[model samples]
Target: MICVDASGVRLAQPDKVLFDGLDVTISRGDRVAVVGVNGSGKTTLLRILTGALRPDSGEVRFGRGVRIAMLEQDPLLPPGTVADYLGDGWEVAAVATSLGVLPLFDRPTDQLSGGQAKRVALAKMLAENGVGAAAEHDMIVLDEPTNHLDLEAIEWLEARLVSMSAALVLVTHDRHALDRLTTQVGPSKVVELDAGRAFVHQAAKGSSAYATYLDARAERVDREAKEESTRKILARKELAWLRRGAPARSTKPKARLRSANEIVSGGPRDLGVRGNDLELGAGSTRLGNQVVELVGVGQRFAVDGSDAVTVFRDVDLVIEPGARLAVVGPNGSGKTTLLDIIAGRRAPALGQMKVGSTVVVGYADQHAASLDPDITVRQMVAGPLREPDHEDKALLERFWFDSTAQYAPTRMLSGGEKRRLQLVMVLARKPNLLILDEPTNDLDLDTLRSLEEFLDDWPGAVVLASHDRAFLDRVADHVLAIEPGGTMRRVPGGVTGWLEERSTRRSASPVRTTKVADAATSSSAGAGASGGGVAAGSRGKQKQASSGPSPSTIGRRLRETEQAMVKAQKRVDDLHAELASTADHVVLAQRGEALAVAQGELDELEARWLELAELQDG
Candidate 1:
């Protein structure tokens, strides 16, 4: 059955046309997604599909008696508290609890932050979708549903959506959600909005719709470039014939001549720009001995005039030059608070933080708090200068803010455009230390990849908190996981290891209460695998005040221990597999012998690694 059918759709903004004569149809069990650049009308398309916004000229029809639930990017709640808005029911409670909305149930909806509002909206939408009821909405549309959600919440939502019977339509920049929904459990469709056109791709029976669409789109762009080249060649030949053949030129057919002239004057097809992604030049300032040091740092928040709630406690962190640290944890687990304290935006409840004299911090917080909404993009990039220079204009263009967009007020820009502008402003000053909180939020995939590339060779210290697993894998050298109850751990295998440990724990205890500090993983680096830690590279050495070996000596030993630990772990795994599958007594004996040796080596490495971590903490 058809859920929604729209044809001959056309929408135009004051500056340019969004889409023209676009056609889309959503059927039962269809998992459809919308993808595009920041201001490429993704949200606008969603609005048109959900009947919230009417197209200039289009035919939209919904299946008879089919119910629809739509979650907007920034939903306006009815005037009331969250409890009043959501009402009472076990189904609502379950969904709200899973989404971390239970705590805010008594708070007024209008007082909630952007993330809180998004979660409330998501919970309401899921509840209405008949999570545990017989009659549910036929279709559910969500705009950036994964925004502000932690990794665990995102996976939970993904599972819920997979189990539902309702058709799903969502817009997001999350690669994991997109890939899993479109490939793992799907016969999905992807609607790609590019260059004022909507290209709908239908996945094959066992194929990945999103991946296929990307490949096909790149091929299309390449084909267009080739055709443009062919046209130019033909046009050049015609020009030569017209200019050189003097007497015969007058005798040539006037219609053919006009056609040739038009082709010669016409510009090339707008396949895309050469380098639309952000180009980040590393900071020029040389970082001193100290980057940012935290001693016994902790944060506490008072709740509803009651006792102050402790977020995290006793976090002793040292960020030196060439260090790439990524923080991960569930929502409201003090990831952002830790980053804020490091950036010196807010002082910890109890701690001593020392900022190096030579350090210049460039912070990109969750919200674009530093921006003035009324100012134009050009004005923001130009700083206090009266006008943006030629270089400033070029810089804006590189970030995908065109000439028209550059002059437009920042308030008018899309969510992604605003985020991009924030990056431009932050990097413009060239800081040696970067503290990014949820930097991947609202950014398009192209810009995200470009940033990952930039950080691969960035000569500075980076501390960021993100729920983007792929982004963390590419950028972070160490994984700093803050479990619920403020017990931070250092995992060896980056995000993958942290995820495995989280999954294993969840499996072992199906029902567990959070915020009760686990005694097993007491502090940041005392326990757990110890390969992922501060990389005191050749660029600079840390200055240690405690009585011990020099920073360089420990750093060298730490690197050596990490490499040996990896080999030892691998050997142990191989031997264990051999012992499990073998029936030969001789083979079993040999494998056992090898396993013992490998285990002993791994234990020594872990102890040495832990000792180094304690030294760094001291």
Candidate 2:
């Protein structure tokens, strides 16, 4: 059944016509992804789909009694507590807990952070698990649903979306989710908007829709290139005829020649201004040997003047010239705090952070504090200057903000556009040392490619935190991993190297070193709260018993537990898929029970797997 049907639609803005004569249809069981460059009307199209905005001219028809659960990028919280907004139910609790928002149930909705609000909104949409509010909705439309989500939460959201029977339409930069979208009954589809036109790519059964879209887009690009060549040839012939004064018009001389003149003037601009890769300028900085170094760095906060809580303690790291370091860990692992200390934005309570005298730091912050929403894009870059010189304009242009976009306020920009603007603001400073946090979050695919290209050859020491797998693999030379326990270690390889050992890390033991001094805890939880030197690295090895389970036996059990965990997880996924594909109430109830059982078994198996891994290594 069709959820939304819009044909011959048109929308326009002050600077450009977003789209013209657009035709779109979303039906139940269709997994559709809308892709476009920043400000290409991705969000506008979603609004039109949900009937929030009326097109200038079109026929928009929804299926009879259709219902849609829409999640916008900036969601408004309803007036109530979190628990009141989402009903009291087990299904709701399960999804909310997965999103890391269950702890906020007692807090007022207005008191929650932006990330918390986003997760709460997501959980509300998914709480039904396709048997309550979700089942009633004929379609679900979301915009940038993965922006504030962590890696684990993103995975859970992907599974939940796949398990819903409602039609799925979303705009996102998450590459993982785009590849795994296999709907219950229909093939996955991608609608890419470019140059006021929409191109549809549909994947065949059991194939990756995103990969198919890339191949198709490449072919279309080649086709457009050939067509441009033909146009150029025709224009040249027409130009020669016009110059030769060989063709005489009857009455309308210049008027009849207008069409040919337009053809000659239009090739790339008429198509679009998606030209020239992003260029980054680095004003020369003579660098010494040292970049940024943190010696015995640690931070702790006092709890109401009664006790102290330590975030991380006794850390030491050195960054030199030409270093490419990627800080990675699960969310809330103090990655951002470490980066801030390195940038000199914040100081550590227990250690020294030294920056080279010649170091010019340019920080692209996750929450861009420099972006003034009320100011124009050009003003944000040029500060208080009444007239931004030609260089400032050119700099903004290089980052895909054309003249019209430069004149527009930053508040008017799309999510991706705002991110691109933030990058411009940071790079305009030409700092030799760059510290970027979550830099690839909302950037378009093309912009990401351009940034990667720039970082590939740019002569600068870079440090960043990102979850984009491809970006991390291409840009980082070394990896710094942080655990929830505040343990930091340098992984030999970057993301790829760490991922290679992720499956077996459970059985791997932390390498211990003899710290000639005592390691002291800064928290009141431990007795040793003060020390002269960093003692964080002296984790004494747990001696193995000679009469307990043999090492070989533990290794065998570890392998067996891993196999069982994988099997049980696969069973859970299969059950979710089956539950989504069916509509019979009785079948759904039965499958739900089985799914719960399977999930519990999977969790138990995973816990056992970790225990065996520790036993094997310890």
Candidate 3:
């Protein structure tokens, strides 16, 4: 059955059109993935199809009584409780529980973090088991749904998508998910958009759609080269005639001289796309006997108001100067916490954790929150270095940050750009030991591949926590598994062995009651009181108390927030700004909307914070 049909759709801005005369049709059981750069109108097209946005001109018609569901990049949910959102049905309850969202039933929607909200949204989407099959609206669209998810959540989503009978259209950057889920769904079509033009190709795992695109790009380059040669020849002929004492019969060529001049003077260049090349220095740092050693390291905390509950215990691990260790476990298994303890970002609850005398450690946190938001690309790169004018610019350029981006703030950067920046920052320290928690998250396939190559060549020790099977296989030589009972074991093959062990353990262990705890109390309570619940009156009182603080303090906080937003914006803006300033002006002009959106979000956040402060005072 036909699921979606959009005809002659047009999306435009004041200066240029994003998509015009675009047409697409999705049928039942179709697994389509929309491929494009950060702002090639991929999400816009999804929104248009989901009826959240109207096209300037065109018709979008769904099959009769289609019960379509959409998981947006950032979904705006209602303010009520999670149960209200999921309804009071048994199937809904089962799905929510299985997805670990049922414990959030009593929690307010506003308190949910990005990852938590994503899980809630996924639970809501999958609540009606077989709804796609039963209701005859076997169609679902997901936009960047994997963002902020951990490894376990990603695996769960992949399984859910594979089992669905619906036609799934997804826009994602996760290659593993795409490879597994899309393969299970069979050969689906791929729609690639470039410069408001759609290129459709049959999707295959390794050598299908991407190969076709490469061929097309090669052909375009050759054609453009020939055109350029012809234009040069014609220009020489015109110049020669003008220079000589010319006859009246040679007044003008067949084609209009002005038009030919336009073509010759302004034509697209033979631009070749180069992938990421992250080369780490091979000079090893001298180690003082031991790099990192953990003896009888254990972590325990109170669970549901009970006595200290053990998450992991009796874990003894050691890393020399050049050891590469991969930590693997299920969601909420404390892999990240253990890394944080070893990196000195967090203190261990018990036992001893130590770094060698000569070791300097660099840590890339699970969420990449170490970045300072108020700084420019150049400032971030040249931290602690003075007069970084030429040196900083060159370094940034090496990481694909150009002139415009070097000056732009970091707050506006995309996920991939921020990640690249983080990698550069971590490498700048030249530490002997590197601790990476899910380092491949939010990175593109090409970048991930480049990182794998870099890790393989680097001489320093690495402790990596990741769920990316392919990445672990490439970079990790030793595997450490955090078993369900909080014991750490050295496994055989890095990721494969870990997976096999997990499967065996799951099959052998008796099923326990899985409950989704409140999000605020789950992993965030010890860090801050932000997620904790307070009575409405008490909350108001606290707000009033904070508002009464000195003007200078309020100003300082506001300034900090502004700076943070600026830093984030700068990173995002630098990537595109650098690309635009260096690339063809026409392409720069074409990508204006995306840059504007990034800037607008930063502005909006600043404005919202200011508004909140004012409300608090009033």
Residue range 1-618, candidate 3, lDDT tens digits: 887888988887564466778778887777777765433577788888777899999999988777678887667789898888878777676666556676678888999876678878877787654454343347889987776555555666788787777888888767667656556425466666655666666655434444454467568668977987887888777666556644445546534455455655665541312343455555346656577767667787776696666666666565765566777766566788888888888877877877788988888875555577888877887785565566456556656665776776778666657877887777766777888987876665545666786776566778888767777777665677665556566665556666666557557964523432222124321110010011111111223333353332343355456657877688666857666566677767656756777777788778867874684244
Candidate 2 contains a number of clashing pairs equal to 1
* TM-score per model over all chains: 0.81, 0.77, 0.68
- Which regions of candidate 3 fall more than 4 Å away from where they truly are? 6-23, 37-41, 54-65, 88-90, 129-137, 147-153, 184-187, 193-198, 204-273, 282-289, 368-374, 384-388, 509-618
Q: How close to the true structure is residue 276 of candidate 3, measured as C-alpha lDDT?
A: 37
| Ten-residue region with minimum lDDT total, candidate 2 | 526-535
For model 1, the stretches where C-alpha displacement exceeds 4 angstroms are: 184-186, 231-273, 282-284, 512-618
TM accuracy, model 1: 0.81
Decoy 2 TM-score against native: 0.77
Candidate 1 residue-wise lDDT, 1-618, digit = tens: 788999989898887778888888987788888887778798999888888899999899889887888888888888789999887798988888778787788888889988889999999888777555754888989898988888877888998988877888988888888877777354688888777887888888767778888898989888888888889998998798778753434545676677778889986654434452454554348888788777666677875686676677656667776677888888878888888888878988976889899998898988874478888889998888577788777777777777888888888988888888888878776888888989988887767877887776566778899988889877776777776656565665678877778789879977544332332234342211111233221112342344665443454466557768888899889889889998999988888888898899899989989998777545
Best by lDDT: 1
Each prediction's Cα lDDT score? 0.77, 0.73, 0.66
Best by TM-score: 1
Deviation from native of the Cα of residue 407 in model 2, angstroms: 2.2
lDDT of model 2 at position 77 = 90
Tell me which of candidates 1 and 2 scores higher on TM-score.
1
Best-to-worst lDDT order: 1, 2, 3
